[model samples]
Target: MKMSDVAKLANVSPATVSRVLSNPDLVSKETREKVMEVINKVNYKPHIVARQFRTKETKIILVVVPDITSAFFSRVLRGIEHVAVKNGYQVILGDTENDTDRELEYINLLLQKQADGMVLLTARQDKEKLEEIAEHFPMVLACEYMDGSNVPTVSIDNISSARKVTEHLIQQGHTKIAHITGPINVVLGRDRLRGFQQAMMSHDLEIDSAYIQEGDFTFESGYNQMLKLLALEAPPTAVFAFNDEMGMGAIKAVKDSNLLVPNDVAIVGFDNIKMASVIEPNLTTIDQPKYEIGKKAMELLLNLINGEALQKKRFVMKDELIVRESSELVKNMP
Candidate 1:
């Protein structure tokens, strides 16, 4: 049935019916319920194609991630989906697989009018290009952050959290601490490395160059880097991996060598993913509010889409360092 027909039966004007169908939050609960009852009883379904043609807007959102299979991104995706479905928007997942060309292809969907807006989980594009896109389109960055660019972003304070994790190792008497870093192309990775350096410098600990290793935020990379660290004549007493996958991989590397965790080599990880707690010798890590970051990113994108002014462009969420068995103090050490 038509909206006008539904409106007539509900004894409400067509505008009221439209408001109820689209922006239910604007209507009073009682009125909304009444309109919904009539809608359900009559089995009224709006002509989506016709509505799109009239508004020149697609009620669709694209959420692009570097890796869709990542547990961290999956949690964030759930939050984005929750906001999109509640606001009558459908979400499309674009897994770019950390490829810049693939990322641009997914972004092209917005340019082609296939989607209304985007929530970028990671961006491989340059600052100027991203700025230009934000100026002309509805976009938001979640988790991945750019330095000094006015792209609306939602993320945790990576530097401070990284410092906290490193300082925890220091407090546990880990002087020769090693670090596995994520790719330094993004600000998240650089800030985390900076935090680690800051904590070490502040404690007057000499950072061995050999102890710092670059990882690609993957399990295999962590395992490989840990192997390198283990081969060093003066191996580090503790190691901090950029993400949980890598941390678990490092733990596996240590176990394979017949070394006991916290007794021989303590380990710390970032991103408190689901597997962190369940793994043997639970990982001590930085707990980023992944779901909240996703929800906020989608909210910001909605505001941008509606031509509403944002109070601030950058939204920094809180992060906590979870102390677990993996980084516990060595009882025999002074």
Candidate 2:
């Protein structure tokens, strides 16, 4: 019913109850737990508007994503929501659809005080502008980040992960390997491409310019790019797509061409989304901890909101290479 009722039920003063609700970190852990138990038992919901009026904060977080329809971003959103709800904050999704102007519009909410903080799933703005906003507002970058910026970020090392996946393909006795890259403009895309190159060069294999096609991390883009690779005079024996959607699209292209996966052309991908495992031929991919990245990003933003110092600006999470059916070919002859 009321916070006072909660306070009475918890046997704590009204001020203590307020502190526990508004600023749980300020209260003792035991006391905070006691207050929370009573509040939960009584089903007490705080007056959000009134609380905002008192604290000059909305307790609202805005998470901006480049593509809302993506399963990878959706998983990340779930993790962010889980943390936000536990900490008495609400999450609002801002789907930018890879539009820079639309992304800026969402950032305006943070500047206008409509949201207490923001977690940018991807940054489309210039580095200077992003730094300016991070300097003034509680913000953290998740999944994607800008180079040479001090903004707090939670992400896996795309370069290293990409290299590992490519090396896996190379080690399987495939010298002719192709890469379907993400948009080269994005940091992750560039890093992944660089890693692919690194692996090829290290193995003394040459990368044909025609074998490299850029995709927009979409199913259509992947599908179209694979067709180009398939039409080449000397098509690659194996392919590595920057993301799983592209990998699946490539598999489709291969099938339509009357070729078999791994038998004719092995394939690998990044971001081990749910569909990767369920596909006709399970995709071998790099598993980025998307949900964990989202959770850590929110935690970092909360620290910024509370004026707590972060131990580090860059939060590099670990990634793993998952071997699956799509790239299961073992070449008996090179």
Error of 2 at 244 (Å): 0.3
Ten consecutive residues with minimal summed lDDT in candidate 1? 325-334
TM-score of each: 0.90, 0.89
Task: Estimate, for each residue in 1-334, the C-alpha lDDT of model 1 and write its tens digit.
Answer: 8999999998989889999977889999988988999999999998989889988888999989998778898789989999999988999999998998999998889888888999999967988998898999999999997888899999998999999999999999889999999998867779999999999999999988999999998999999999999999988989999999999999999999899887899999999999999998999999999989889999999999999999999999999989999998897763
- The positional error of residue 285 in candidate 2, measured at the CA in angstroms, is 0.2
Q: Mind giving the per-residue lDDT tens digits that candidate 2 earns over 1-334?
A: 8888888999999899999866789999999999999988888998988888888999899999999988789889999999999998899999999998999999999999999999999876999988988999999999999887899989998889999999999888899999999999888889999999999999899989998999999888888999999999888999999899999999999999999898889999999999999997999999999889999999999999999999999999999999999989665644
User: Could you tell me which residue pairs clash in candidate 2?
Assistant: none
Angstrom error of the Cα, residue 313, model 1: value is 0.9
TM-score of predicted structure 1: 0.90
Q: State model 1's lDDT.
A: 0.92
Report lDDT (CA) for all predictions: 0.92, 0.92
